[model samples]
Target: MVKTIITLLMMIILFLGGTLFGIDQASEGIIQTRGYATADVKEAVQPSRDEAGNVEVELLGKDLQQVTFEEKEQEFQEIESSNFTQKLAGSMEKGVSSFYNLMIQSVYQLVQVFF
Candidate 1:
């Protein structure tokens, strides 16, 4: 039948197309294979600070502490307590904060685009 002949021709065309595509990809991969090469990397040039003086800004509440070493160690231990409740609470807070920040950013961008 004509239908059968058409189907067979279509199948043959598809098969040939796929074969040619695969062969092309294989040839490209082979051609791209590197046998050997030596590369010399130059050292990075440092920027001159004299050209532009650095400006450091510290956050409002983050001041240098005058606490003793023992007090600092105690505070660190309190912070680093590996309790299940603390870990879960901290993770949840971070996740919520991240989602809130993303939502604010998305709204800001959408507003900017519209306005």
Candidate 2:
């Protein structure tokens, strides 16, 4: 029983761990959740005095406009870009969940057998 649980946890961790790479918008693009745009920058609450210490959030323009308030947003009319790497990476990255899920299911079956 202990071995099964340990094995299950190990499988879950290994499945989630990996080098994820790809071209994603450096910021959320206009097409992302249209109604919620976040700020472009902010003060980092963390204690790191690195280069551009300021924190920048990636959000789509429409979302940004909506966030800042539409009346104020209308003044800008429009913004643009296609710098999303994570989304593109998501498209290109291989789906590895199934194999691990199968392993877990197999364990479940084996555990059931023992019971």
Candidate 3:
């Protein structure tokens, strides 16, 4: 009986080890495929700093340009204004919950009035 238990335990350990190794390999393959899909494997270039240690960002490329703080704020506001789906979803959730609460309250009030 002891020998049988030992053999069974060894088989269980081997099976678990193989399962974990397969899982690791599968996850590695997924990560590699994701990296390939993004095509952004190169290391990112760090922003150059000035003598006073102030962070200086140099925007390269033709389409990029440095904007004022007001411009950035306006851009953020525009993005927020354009997010209609998020606002709609939030309002729908609120309406559904409010309706559910109203139904429960009406039931409770009816029971109190009757009994």
lDDT preference between candidates 1 and 2, better one: 1
Residue range 20-112, candidate 2, lDDT tens digits: 211235235553655455564333332323355543343432221113468556655443234367657775554556667888999999999
Cα lDDT listed for each candidate: 0.72, 0.55, 0.81
Q: Name the regions of candidate 2 deviating beyond 4 angstroms.
A: 1-84, 91-94
The number of the candidate with the highest lDDT is 3
In terms of TM-score, which candidate is strongest? Answer: 3
lDDT of 3 by residue, 65-96 (tens): 34679999999999999999999999999999
On TM-score, who's better, 2 or 3? 3
> lDDT by residue for model 1 over 1-115, one digit each (tens)?
9999999999999999999999999776765674322243222333223324543333333433334689989988877785779789999999999999999999999999999
Candidate 1: global Cα-lDDT? 0.72
Least lDDT summed over 10 consecutive residues: which range in candidate 1? 41-50
How many Å off is the CA of 66 in candidate 2?
A: 14
Task: Give me candidate 1's TM-score against the actual structure.
Answer: 0.30
